[model samples]
Structure formats: C-alpha cells, structure tokens
Target: MFVAAIVGLLVSMLFALVRAFLGPTIYDTILSVNVFGTKTVLLIAVFGFLMGRPDFLDIALVYALINFVGVVAVARLAQSLLRDKVAMLIACVCDSQWDC
Candidate 1:
C-alpha cells in the first residue's frame, strides 16, 4: 500500500509538471508548480514513514515552508512586473498627442 501511495504521488507530480509547461497563463503555471511542490512534500512524508525514519518529517516541513515562501515571492515579483508594464503603457499614452 505504501508503494502504491508513492506511485500515485509520482504520477500526480508528473501531471502537475505537464500542466506547468502547458499552462495558458503565468498564474496557471505558478499554480501547477505549487501543486507539484505540495505533492513532493507528501511523497517525502510517506516515504519517511515507510522507511521508519521520523527525521524525514522535519525535512519535509522545511521543504514545505521553502516552497510556500518561494511561490509567494515569485508571484509578488510577477505582479510588480505587470504593474510596471501597465505604468509604462499609461505614461506612453499620456505622452503621445494622438488618442490611443
């Protein structure tokens, strides 16, 4: 059963990876990456249990935290970049004499 769970997690991770590559928008890709990270955490936890090592849970927890922080940071960076682009477009339109 544990092996089955690990296989399932691996399959789910594979699907997430595919979606990340084929996602229609940046947000969708980000979401898929996040999902992949989450499944990785689960995989680690399960494998730790199967191996009788409690220490793996700690590693999994740390990984989860890092994943959460990394995703948030990336999302904030993307939003700021989008905002900058909009501001640039507004400035360009305002500077132009002809109506856009």
Candidate 2:
C-alpha cells in the first residue's frame, strides 16, 4: 500500500510537471509548480515513514512551509511586476492624450 501511494504521488507529480510546461499562462504554470511542490512534500513524508524515521517528517513539514511561502512570495512579486507594467502603459496613454 505504501508503495502504491508513492507510485501515485510520482504519477501525479508527472502530470503536474506536464501542466506546468504546457500551461497557457504564467499563473497556471506557477500553480502547477506549487502543486508539484506539495506532492514532493507528501512523497518525502511517506518515504520517511516507510524508513521509520520520524525526524524526516519534521524536515518534510519545514519543506512544506517553505514551499508554500515561496510560492506566495513569487506570486506577489509577479503581481506587482504586472501591475507596474500596466501602470506604465496607462501612464503612457495618458501622457499621449494630455500634458501629464
């Protein structure tokens, strides 16, 4: 059963990887990557449990937290950059229409 769980996780990870690569938008790819990261954490935890190392679960928890925080940070950074680009485009349009 544990082996089956690991295999399922690996298969899901593969699917996530495919989605990330084929995503139509940056956000979709980022989401897929986040899902892949989560599966990786689960895989680690399961493997640790199979090996009888509870300490590895602690590592997995840390990895999961880092992955979540990293994804949020990247998403926020992308949003800000996109916003800045849109703001610049608006400014350019305004400048062309008026003396601002």
Candidate 3:
C-alpha cells in the first residue's frame, strides 16, 4: 500500500509539472508549482517512513511550511502587480484634462 501511495504521488507530481508548464496565467502556474512542492514533501516523508527514520518527518514539516510561505508570497506579489496596474490606469484617466 505504501508503494502504491508513492506511485500515485509521483503521477500527481508529473501532472502538476504539466500544469505548471501549460498554465495560461501566472497564478495557475504558481498554484501548480505549489502543488508540486507539496507532493515533494509527501514523497520525502514516505521515504523516511520506509527507511524507519523518524527525523525525516520534521524535515517534511519544515518543507511544508516553507512551501506555504512561498505560495503566499507569490500570491501577494501578483496582487500587488494587479493593484499597481489598476492605479496607473486610474491615474492616467484622472490626469487627462479632457474630463475637467
């Protein structure tokens, strides 16, 4: 059963890779990448368990936290970029004297 879980995780990782490569938007790509990261963490944890190494779980936990933070950072950056674009458009419209 463990082996099957590993195989399933590997397949999911491959699918995530495809999504990351073919995503139409930056957000989609970022989300795919995040999913890939999560799969990696799971893989590591499973391998550690197979090897009877208890310390590996700690590493996996750290990796999961880091992955979450990375995803959040990417999302924040995209949001900021969108806000900047909207602000620029508003400024351009307001500065035009034709409306005054």
lDDT of each: 0.93, 0.91, 0.92
Estimate TM-scores for all models: 0.82, 0.83, 0.84
| Clashes found in each candidate (C-alpha, N, C closer than 3 A) | 0, 0, 0
Question: Over 4 Å off in model 2, which ranges?
Answer: 92-100
- Distance from true location, Cα of 33 in model 1, Å: 1.4
Model 2: which residue pairs collide? none
Clashes of 2: 0
**Candidate 1: minimum summed lDDT over ten consecutive residues — where?**
91-100
Error of 2 at 48 (Å): 1.1
User: lDDT by residue for model 2 over 1-100, one digit each (tens)?
Assistant: 7788999999999999999999998888989999999999999999988788878888889989999899889989999999999999999999999964
State model 3's lDDT.
0.92
- Please give, for residues 51-98, the per-residue lDDT of candidate 3 as tens digits: 889799999999999998998899899999999999999988888956
Candidate 3: residue 24 Cα off by (Å): 1.1
Error of 3 at 88 (Å): 3.6
Put the candidates in TM-score order, highest first.
Answer: 3, 2, 1
Stretches of candidate 1 exceeding 4 Å from the true structure = 92-100
On the 0 to 100 scale, the lDDT of residue 23 in model 3 is 97
Tally clashing residue pairs in candidate 1: 0
